[model samples]
Target: MKKRICVLAMLSLCWGVTDATAAGPDLDGYVEFGGRLFDVDGDEAKFNEYRDIDNGVYGNVDILSYWEGGYYIDFLAENIAYDDQAYWLNGGRFGSLKYLLYYDEIIHNITEDALTPYDGIGSDTLVGTGETEPALWNSFDYKKEREKYGGDVEYAFENGYFVQFGASNMESSGVMPYGGTSSAEFPAPIDWEENQFNITGGYRAKKLTASLTGQFINFDNEDDSLTRDDTIGSLPPDNDVAKVLGKMVWRPEYYGSVVALNAGYSKTESDEQLGIVVPGETRNFDGEITKWHVNGSWKFEPIEDLDLKLLARYDDRDNDSTVLTTLDGNENENYSSEIFKTGIEADYKLSRNNRIDGGYHYLNKDYEGRSDSDGADDNLFFIQARNYSLEDVELRAKYSFLTRSGDYTVEPGETDEGYRSYDVADQDRNQVELEGGYYGVEDLGLDLEFTWFNADYDDTEVGLVELDHYDLYFSGTWAIQSNVNTGFYVGFERDYSEDLGDAAETTYYTYAAGLNIEAYFMAEKLRLYAGWDWAESDGKSEFDSADIIDTDEVEDFTQHILSLKGTYFIDEAWSVTLGYVYEEWDYSDDQWNNYVIVVPGSRGDTFLSGAYDDQDYEGHTGYLSVKYKF
Candidate 1:
């Protein structure tokens, strides 16, 4: 009710200003409550329905408090209450001796639409039906709220400097999912608002340090459910950004050494509404972007276990020029682009058991916005090794390489002196890894690892393909007595594919296993754990030949999981937790049998492909909390 009477009038104005400032020293904080439950199974009906409280529950409640002293006043609060009862509050603070203020608020009362299939349209329908879809009952109960307030006041001197000015006001509203309605029962356009501002300066020394800051952001969404006033015809529009930065550091103790320098610049203006089609629609003008950088490092020992090092960096960018339109308004303006980069690194310590390292990098780019005058270049390399043996064993290895080439532009008034020129694709990549370990059992333990990868691409881009990979792993652990502990692991992975217009190549593999156990009763506040996992996969494609391109069959899937977790310490301010999970999925590919369906005008919404063809899923969770400290 009126947010619990504004959190009891800010906790009675923070205890009436701490009993009229009884001379400092008094701090307090408290409050918490919780809830969560989720159960899901795959094979359609949108992936096991929960369309908002059809029995399954989701609940929560929370209220927070805080206070501090020494420099006078400080207090904070956060509130949240839900279970469809709806409530929100995010926190704020106020300071004394003159002035200082802060504020933050977020009120969300989302009417469970099964949490909108977990955002981003159920991850684009699990990348187009690799499964998961279902949950749209009524589908239009959404509420969003916002409140932001800021403050700053400065006047300090002890031998340091400070200056400040800050301001903020942000107000937001319900259901604005960018895009005109399609379906899901519309009714959400509760108006909108946004605002921001800042200014700052600082300096400190014992060696050297400095700072400066600035910011501005504003927005006014004139109804129409947040920005859509005639799509690109503007109304209460906004977009502006500005930046500046500088830094420096130097240390010299009779030339023992340290040095640093940094710089920055930025500018931006908007109102094009995000567009990029490079053949007709290309928006992002009202431009200005610039950048620069530099770096340095050094260290020395020149003895003992031996040590050495070095490093470097550089970068750049620029753009500005407008006029590009589409969405049936058609207009264009000559474009632009540019980029550059550099790098270097090193390390060594060939003793006390040996060590080595490496690095290298470079990149370049230039293109007069689309009409082709393109450019490209990239390169990298690396190496590493280490060993320490006398029987307790330990070894490691690594290798890496990368390469690239340039020139590309296709379609859109084809340029670069035309003639259909758009070929400058070349790439090569390689990687290797190896590892070994031993801890001379006294508690029993072991580990092993191996990896390899390769990639090649040249003058080809249609579905661009070429890659090879491999991996292997093994692990072990045991202490079957010290409060009990155990572990196991196994893994294998492989993938090979090549198809540059029917050069045809395919291969796939996946296998895994895991197990873990742990226990430690009373003497450790109580603890328990369990884990198990398994996985499998295999490959081929070409269905309905629309220029033949389909792969992913021979899929044998298996999954089984069981877990029970616990923690209890009902004494030092209270604590309690319990968890249980069970999972099952097994499928013998028949291309998933076209994923059974029957919910278009529901007859009790059906889609049970054998309920996951070997189904068995269950989940139960529990929590009890009570905390208090002052």
Candidate 2:
């Protein structure tokens, strides 16, 4: 509330300044006033999941003013009285100096119907109740709020040099569900903030350009631990990062050649206090990680209708965390990784409307102090063809193949038995894609796309075995006249994966489809618009083993959205608009539908019904607004 008040006061002051100093033909902008009403049938949280779209009054203001010396100011404020509000202000001269200020707020609504059996919720400490009755529990909502404010400035010199600086701070606070020591769940408090700063300088010339940047970031958490039912758990710790980056691009005066280079280095560190300490161990832990990368590319045209490019990169990460020798009698693993990659590509024009492209790439990764395999290497090859020889028609097709090999030998005492990590497993992947577009019909346009992908991990005995994906999409648009148009799009997708385990061999599948249609009509005095969209998805998991049984559908969902609006121009300087929106959602999950709130015994598991329940809703909204331009 204090933030909102400050924003209002600032806006008022700006208006006062404008009224006092503005002369004729020096000011121009628009202001809009509006109000919205909502009618909902189900949970409100589902309707306003990541935004604040409730019944309220809203206003928007935009102003632009300039002086005779190439100086100007631009300001905009939106959703003035709502939770999802934003404000921006910027001023500068033409190609000389510029500054900016901005602020925004967002609300994340998790759930509005949740029940708990603990006292002192949303605090550091919580008390337990022996009773396991569901009717006697307390009800509360789970949500969070995030706010950010920032500003930046830039200055340019006449000698092809420029500098920019920026800073921002963000804070988040709320309560969310977390699992406790036992089978019970609790709502935990959250309070954290992050601050970031960066500065950059660059030089621009006709043949060469270069830039360098330095950045620093810090993060803090107010509550480091929580106590529930005689058990204490540690939360997120304080951390910070500092980094520097540089980039350069140079162009030679021969054969349209170019060269580019980039490099960066960063380090992150964290400190935390231990909740439970041994007799001979320290009370705190300090951890650090460092990373660096360098990459470069060169492109040149060797002859007529031929172009070639080469690129390469190297990356490294080092982890140096505190060892727990005094407490556990074992040293911590470094868990570091390094990567090197190189690639070459070529493009040739068969004719004025025909072209072909091909590329080959190789990558290798190495790991230290890992229980899994040591590392993996990959090789990829691809080719593409495009043609625009037919009048008003275009076509494109591409194919790619890749292979991966890893060292799967396990160490005797350090590795898990009969386990293979997928990240370093032996695999083969293939993909194919095709796209086409036609504009031969007068005032009509059409496009179509299709894709297929497959991955086989045949060498592994107890991990992912196979994966497949497919997609198809189509869209079309028709322009009946200069001021009238309509368009529609549709898409279909499917994904499948198969895995092997000790007890059962499981396969998971998902399928989805979506459609959208839109129309616009412009008249002499009134304009009209309409849009509609619908989507549906379904998922299933099956187990094929001697001792396990398959199950029914795991999840299903559907959504629909419709909107209509019209604007009536009373005159050149004033207009009014009326709009309506409708949204419907239907969702279901098999696990949540059969879950029990509390078990009967003292040693049984307990749960809060509100934390993971399904949401189904239908909502309607209407708004009216008037705008004036000067």
Candidate 3:
């Protein structure tokens, strides 16, 4: 509520900008208001609309006011009264200082129709209701809301330099679903606060620009742990982070060279004690990360009709943190990686309408722990070419191959090499891609793309052995008339994995991924769009060992969406817009078929099953809005 008041006060200040002088300042604006309706059932919850509005009254404001040079105001607000509300307001001129303020709200509706057996849904304590029947379960809606507001102030000098100061605050309050080993799944409360402050200064020049920034971030959480049927350390405590970043981009006209450098150092630490972990003497996590990178690209015309380009980049991340160990001898982990990359390419013109270019790239990666199970080092090589030899057709292709080799396999916090498993494993990967774009006609455009990826694991035991992937996409847009336009798109993707290892040497799992298509037509005053997407993925794991068990989990779903909107000009300055939208979600999973469970707990209350998160559902939205612009 305080945030809302702050926003309202800011709005009031904006309106005051027009009333500063008796002569009155120039003011122009428009307001939009509309109504919408939607219906959702208890058993049928729409997770997609968790963060967005499914049904409600909608309103917006767009305004700009100015008083010559004294003061200027601009505000663009959307969904003003809804959960997904946001606005930006910038207005202020004090001597040479300028400022802007903005606010954004994000919401997650979660399950609107959750059936639980507990009361006090939003409070800290939850008491179970003895009702065991699914029909008699208590109903609740879980949601998360984050509110962020910030302002930025900058001072500019006549000599081409500026200094900026910014501060922001974000607060989150919500409930999430979590499960426990000894108890049924339940909702947990969340109350988080994050504050950030930063200062930046930059110098601007005709051929060079540079900036440096420093920031401090603090996160505080009220609910460090949740105590319901089971007391669990469910959240991380307060933490403070500080970082400094610098960036520079330089261009030397004499050699046509461009240089870019970016570097940063960040340290994060939290000393809050967690009583659940055997009440250790030291805090669990204290980490620091340092990042640095430099990139440069140069273009030179050594000869006529020939262009040469050279590029290089170096990036590294170094992590050093105090490792806190538990009484059981368990310790924290750390990772640091570095990369070096360079590439060169050249283009030669065969004629005014033809050109060809090829490039080679190399990348080497090194990590601190070369013996970790997930692979620690990699070297990649690539060569690519493009030929623009045809008047109406252009083609481009690239291929990359790489191999990975690691030292001994081991897991962190333990010295036992026998207990380590390499899932990604020592392997070879080959990637190929081709893309083409055609824009020969003034009224038409087309794009086609293809990609193939294959990975072979040479030495793997009881893990993913090999995988193959493919993707295809085609899209085009054509102008049917000067006042009409239409476009269509289609895409398909597939991935296949084979892992058949026995006991110490075998693993098996397989699946498939899908196709998306869209078409749209727009006229001077009418627009129609439709999209359809479907995906089916089902994989199972199996081991031949008598001690091993086979597992299966399938994911299958399809979504359909259709929208039509048209605007009719009542006059040169007035218009009306009518839009209708239809959406459908279809889901089918084998494991949760008509799932319903009600178990009487050792405590007096009954435990109930959660709602099917992705059940089939359809939605329709219709709106008629009027607008006036002068």
Candidate 4:
């Protein structure tokens, strides 16, 4: 009640001011109040039971009242005096009818997990004595705050000529530690902050338009957290980067309608640090990297029913590093790369309801590792067709081919400097797909799709490789009534790979099916849904050992979700809503286990197989919200 009174008082104050001046500016805004709760359960033993509680009262208020004779002001505040995890303020103005200004500030809190790679130390190596290592895991949480302010002013004439200029600055701060440790173990957490500023100006005419924009970013480390001997040292500070872009458009009624041209330039620079452990001693290395890119594109309609586009881009990167060792050793290494890409595309309408499109792209990259340089090139071409009939049926088909060649470099031995390199050539791939959908039935639909892919790789250092894959899928949905519906889908995929020599090739296959049912009631405000999913994948791969490995897995999962929500109209300017949701994820079989090990590993390889071990996950979220609009 107190909060409501405060809001009403503020609204009344603004209204009083507006009423006094017949020519005053208009005022408008809305306020929202709500809260949320969540819970999670999984089969992996590591995540058998997890709970997160997030509940808060939030709202926003904005006042845009102007004085007589062309003077205006606007103010906005949100999450006002609340314990919730979000807050912000924004306000701006446009003088009379020509100038503009604005500013905003926001803060947020997020909870997540952290996992760091094991630098081949201890029992975490993939080869040698300590092979098949486990990843280190820890729970993480952090808070972030961001602030920005900028605005643009423009003068418009009855003519097509209009000019505008604007500039903005943004800043953010968060916690970043050197070593991938949980927040609980940090003696002193490093404060990380970054700032960016940009300025843009443009002009527009009847047949031509152009704009130029430039931006810069700087990152700094405010506190040092990691010690020299702790495997992770203090992070670098004060990294500066900049980018500039220019765009132009031209449209002449003569050559088949609209035509536009665009061009841009970007550059980045950063100083990076790397830590290595030699025997029992630790060493730190410093490196400087610079990268630049130039790109351009052209678009136009060459015919009455055809559209064409052409694009090209070039990028160059250089790295210079100072290597340091525990034995007071120092050396310098340089790496450079140049990459180029170009592509052309065309789309043509065969009829009023049918269309066809095709594109071709080429990429070339030359990389210099130390004193040696290697190059790789790739070419790709694809074409697709789509047709739509009056009966509510749609069909699509596409085919693509890609060929690539390249050489890669790596470190060979244990050294603070460069050591290993590999050369690769003749890598090619081809793919074909077809899809169709039917929606002629009232509140019912069906979809089907199939894809086939093949790839071949021939390398002198890594041996020859060949791969093939096929995929098929089907889905359909039916609306039992205006408030109820049901749907189901099934898919199958297979992959086969072969290598040279007596090394046995590997094959993998996956099959999945799912069904969903949903019903809505209470004037479409309340909804309930239930679903079941089953999937299985089997494959074999060659481990570090000479022997061939085999893998077989299957998983069945089900989820039940229920939600109830309704809105109550208290008055013309006020309303309230109550809502709740309950969901669960149940898993059965080894398929879930494989997914936990592989998918999570890619995110810093922090796979906690134990996290989802023997149990399923259940979550419940509920919220109540009230909104007032004027």
Q: Residue 355 in model 4: shift from native, Å?
A: 2.7
TM for every model, in the order presented, reads 0.23, 0.92, 0.81, 0.66
lDDT minimum window of 10 residues, candidate 1 = 122-131
Model 3 TM-score, 2 decimals:
0.81
Model 2, 6-26: lDDT tens per residue? 576558745754774547327
For residues 209-262, write the lDDT of model 1, one tens digit per residue.
566666666665644212111222212335565666665555555334445555
Best by lDDT: 2
Q: Write the number of the candidate with greater lDDT, choosing between 3 and 4.
A: 3
Model 3 ranges off by over 4 Å: 17-29, 40-56, 65-72, 91-98, 115-120, 123-138, 180-184, 272-375, 410-424, 440-442, 499-553, 598-614
Q: Give per-residue lDDT, candidate 2, residue 365.
A: 90
Q: Give the residue spans of candidate 1 off by over 4 A.
A: 1-103, 108-141, 145-151, 156-162, 165-175, 180-197, 200-240, 243-321, 327-329, 332-630
The 0-to-1 C-alpha lDDT of every candidate, in the order given, reads 0.53, 0.80, 0.68, 0.59
Ten-residue segment with the worst summed lDDT in candidate 4? Answer: 120-129
RMSD of 1: 32.9
lDDT of 3 by residue, 1-630 (tens): 867786797778766654664676777777777776655332234634554655667877777776767667788788887777888888666456688888888887666667777776766566767666767877776678899999999887878798999999999998777553234667767789999999999988878889999999999988765555434444556888888888887878654556666677777766444434233222455556667676777777777877778888777777776665666797656767777778787777877655666666666566664345433455566666676777777888888887776544553334454343453357799999999999899988899999999888765544566787887888888876665566777777776666544333222222222222233334344444444443444444545667866445444556666666666766656767777766666666556656665565644343444645647777777777777664
Ranking by TM-score: 2, 3, 4, 1
lDDT head-to-head 1 vs 2, winner:
2
**Highest TM-score model number:** 2
